[model samples]
Target: MVARQFIVRHDDDDHHIEHDTDDGFEVLQSQIFSLTLVPPDQQKILANVNDAAINADSDLAAVSDRLVLVSVQDQREISISDEELARLLQAEEEAVYLQQFQASGNRREFENRVRTYVPQVFLYEDPMRQEAARKTVPVDEIEEKSLIFLAKETSGHQTMKKAMPSYWSYSLGSKNLSGGTSGMGMGVPLPSEIQYGGSRVELYWCNKCSKETRFPRYNDPIKLLETRRGRCGEWANCFTLYCRTFGYSSRLILDFTDHVWTECYSHLLGRWMHLDPCEGEYDKPLLYEKGWNKKLNYVIAISKEGVYDVTKRYTRNWHKVIRRRNITTEADISAVLSDITSECRRSFSREITSTLKIRDERETEELETNVHIPVGDSLSLPGRQSGSKEWRMARAELGSSDQNNSEQRHKDEYVDSHVTRIHAAFSHLTSRISKEGVKAIKKLLEDLRASPFRERTAVLESQGIPHLGDLLEAISLKGSVRPDGRVSVGLAGDPVLTSLALPVALDVVEKIINKGGNSD
Candidate 1:
């Protein structure tokens, strides 16, 4: 006897396991186990072997050993070999490294970096994919039953009758029941099988669509429904509003010259489809510019997402379009577009992924590049001039605002009317106040400080700054300084008015000072 040490192990059940065995004894034990393993069980053991064969040779054995260990643990009692345990850990580490490599090579990050080379001015906001996903909800799909009813009601209108497609009448008259909701309780009349020409004439209805007939006093959809006669703009606005009521992503596209139309997101097409309600046309994007032979310089599309200058879509020739778009220079238009796109990205649905955003930006860049032409020393054709002091100041205010308020201006007729009234008053006051001298404007400011908040905003809103620089200089010269760094001017009796007016006054002064300093 040689001095030899033997080791023993026990599981939770207190079953002993032998260790420190020679190759000869272990082989004999394996032979005995193999003899007991039936053909059915051998298939289970070989399944892991087949799985390992598909992997690379370096990790193949390690993976197979791990699978064998797992199968053994599940099927029968067995002690794990130390070599197999080490191989299993090696395989896991290799797997983790491979995953990290794959994650680090994300295509999205690469695409984003590529997009950085393109100018921000060239980027645009697009929400087609997001709008498509939103269409999955029942509420998002427009009740065609409502459209059918509206078409029938407006079909007799001479202008609308010409515009209405024959299929619309057939679709409504015939029992083609696809894509229509249950109109039973919705107050919508059922489709009539009896086909009839649109020959009905009501006393209030116009024999021919006139300019006066189109401008409805009320532009709401409900009101439009009651009154079947409206202008192209009104019809478009009402149609867009109705589409929105049914949960469709809709926008009112305005051609700065005069025309208006609706753009509704089409889930079937996976993009926005132009719908001219007045004309009863769908997806006819070029109908205005091409069909009507209209010269369009600017086509603005306003939606809840944001405002967009979609002139490129309407104008194929950039050089010709830029000549007509002389009201705003290229630089100014670029600034406005950038402001609008940024605002949309901030406020649009969160589901809009970065990949889609980048794709939209690339498309915009292509459009911009195609249309861009250098004017150099040559000026564009003379259009509407906005060089007056008040117009210039308003332009400055619009540019200075954090977000472009152009969309806000076109949100509704109510807001537009208020703005128009305010603008007119502002123009009058600016001219009179400047002629009367800065002293007269300073007196008006002193009166405003003591007024209430409502009165202060009313005056500011009504009488915009006549000469921002002169007004601010007069205030700083006439008003007393407070401890809090605000000028103590305006109505001393009303604290809210004084508080509101002082900040606004100071902000105007700072902007004027900055503007002058920048020029110098």
Candidate 2:
């Protein structure tokens, strides 16, 4: 048999007319049937439908003597079944549509399309369960799944929302009282009260109320709120969930020494800021080593994005941290990071992957160059750079203000403790200006006189007393102080308590009458 070629053009392009080649014609026919070429004109190509008649054609017979019949579409040079042709056309249309979308400037639109290819990551509260799931997934799939997990909006609620301004102000102002729940009332407090509350009152409440459980629980924020508290690990876990619920990108940072906190990504600042719910502190990475005097080893931050060894942020000196770090080699860390990042990026399109890779490189550069280091000069510290006199004075003022707050906090605690002690001793005393009340008032007066002007103010404010006038009014003209601290207008004609308490009452009254004017 001799090879034959056929010239074919279904569109404007010139056709390569192969005059005498069997293989070329077969390939060309196959291309047409595969939808590479527009289907040939039906009137010209299908002269005869019967196999014998098609085999009789000189051009068709040269390629294949069998000359099996094939279906052709009218719109294109396609010799395939109708269903297959329709699918190929739809696929082509979709490809073009995606190309157009990707070329457009809308990053969100492109991201939406890219997400279809990524597998959904269902992260659990349990780390062991999460590790099991992680093992089941390919390394390349981790990043995309992580991104989805980070931004997962379940039931239209964001897990990582930015916190309110009041919260920030309160967090920044309040002192880090690591333990004790004294002075923090159970009732919901005003925003200003939290700022001026003098301690981590919420953490106090959590510690006091939450039942101690032997089994570990990485409770969500809602559950923690309901239960009122947990261990340090649970506190950090819940706090992280709270940040995420508010639409903030937060990571759960775990220290080998059994401490956990959160690192939130600040979009405005374009970096992670350390936040500790237990301490009521933010952006204080060095607090662990410098303030708490902790000896840390591995500090890992695990987020949906990936797992990162963030020990460098807390440790100022690399040599010291390296010695302490339990990880055998830096190469292992790098390998783990690479595997996680690759898994996260697995489902991303080339463009998105490239963009993220570049961004990651920039972040790595920033992390390496900007890790906090100790400064010899106090004034040379980051954010407190030596500058104009005005700047120096402002820094000094801030330092002074913090010191003053601390001092006032201690004084307020003293008064509160004394008052609480009195309450404890005279548990059945109903009236604030009774014999027992009078004695308590006398003790408070003696303490208040020794206290600086600020402590007096703090006691008044903290105790819900409006002014010194009210206190003075209660001392002189009262039968007894009311539950609300108001003085009764009339004098007490009857003595309810035994004579033993009468002297304490009279003594308290005499001291208040003489010292009320000098109290300020």
Candidate 3:
């Protein structure tokens, strides 16, 4: 028997133990007992697939996989700090993510899946066939219960005037129920399951239609041309095919956060331009992040040409989005994508493929560059413009209409509170940090705060995101924020405070104090 690794979580931390014992999973419990002093009955061991037993090596898969042994005792819950619990949750998420990552990277299941589920499958054939379909939409005869119609109707706020279905239990509000569980692949769609296995069933209400209304859930995008009704998925699918049929090299993009859009390669600009058919939006990759306020993770673009991970193109907050990308190492994902792209282009001539490879490299560079460089000026991007106002708000994709107003109010309050903190820190630092004339630096900041907005704007620009205490060290020396909240030094980290040597952390403060750098 091959030895397996187990994370024996006892008190403060986790202990990894190896076991060659066979027979049943009780052997794992026994091994855990030897270390944690927890009895066999009290130990709860969980795996990625089965929490109950591991009869073979096949059950143990993926790099992040490990057995989590939880002790069932009185103090178990109480002893865990919020940080430790969060860490354990992240570990569990990584394990589940790795399982899917390996499965997605498998050449066999992947190619078949790509053929079936990837947006590239929705192709353009005869223009006449597309025209005919566009001209006609047959009444779709669906099975009585096959369709799940979900909705949120409101007079103003989200409230249920009429009682919903008694058996309809939803993870969120009044969505007409289709059952899902808490187990892997069985449960309600979770944050961690984005890239691996997914299915789309747009939940929208039909006005003046009965539950028995027979509408066909057409898989083919050509059929969507005539019907012309769908959520983001259908809209993007239909539009992508239309673009291709019209002689544009188009791709369909699937956002793992339950949205879909189109991308068309522009010969004029020699780049793929973002097109959200639903939003009537064009060329704005950061629209979802800046406008709809969508916290996106995985956004894969697929066409007849190739598959691409285009998530970075759609975000400026790559730092936060990175934590959700635990499906696999980026290198493994690139490997899988490269293989898939090769297979996709196998039919093309060597010259054509070479041209494609160059284009791919250029696009890759463009997307990576976009990760750091931000767009948009003083006026923020518009909110989600496609869905119903209520629906958009429910999705929290309503962007910065009323949100900007509320945020401004909150920001004013935050700035007022933060100014007091900055003043204290500045005072403390002025006493300790004597480099570059601390008095002058202090007076400079004080002038900036009391100065008019135009004068402050003349001096500093918006810099990095701000936080006060612990994070202050991270921002300090590297950047500065005007106490009035108008400007931030180091707009994209050029270091506007380079001339002044200021105390950032406790250690720096201690060193300065001990050196007697203060001019008292």
Judging by lDDT against the true structure, name the best candidate.
Answer: 3
In model 2, the worst 10-residue window by lDDT is 164-173
Instruction: Return the TM-score for candidate 2, rounded to 2 decimals.
Output: 0.36
Q: Please give the lDDT score for candidate 3.
A: 0.53
Alpha-carbon TM-score of each model against the true structure: 0.31, 0.36, 0.43
| lDDT of candidate 1 over 68-182, digit per residue (tens) | 2111212332244667555644654554445444343343432332233122111111243234323332331122223322333422122222333222121111133343322
- Extract clashing residue pairs from model 3: 181-187
Candidate 3 runs further than 4 Å off: 1-115, 119-122, 126-128, 131-211, 376-379, 402-520
Candidate 1 structure, TM-score to reference: 0.31
List residue ranges in candidate 2 displaced over 4 A: 1-222, 349-355, 377-520
Q: How many Å off is the CA of 163 in candidate 1? A: 13
**Per-residue error at 231 for model 1, in Å?**
0.6
Report lDDT (CA) for all predictions: 0.40, 0.43, 0.53
Candidate 2 clash figure, as a count: 25
- lDDT per residue for candidate 3 within 120-147, as digits (tens), equals 3435555664565444422121111111
Highest TM-score: give the candidate number. Answer: 3
Candidate 1 deviant stretches above 4 angstroms? 1-216, 267-270, 340-356, 362-520
- How accurate locally is residue 490 in candidate 3, as Cα lDDT from 0 to 100? 29
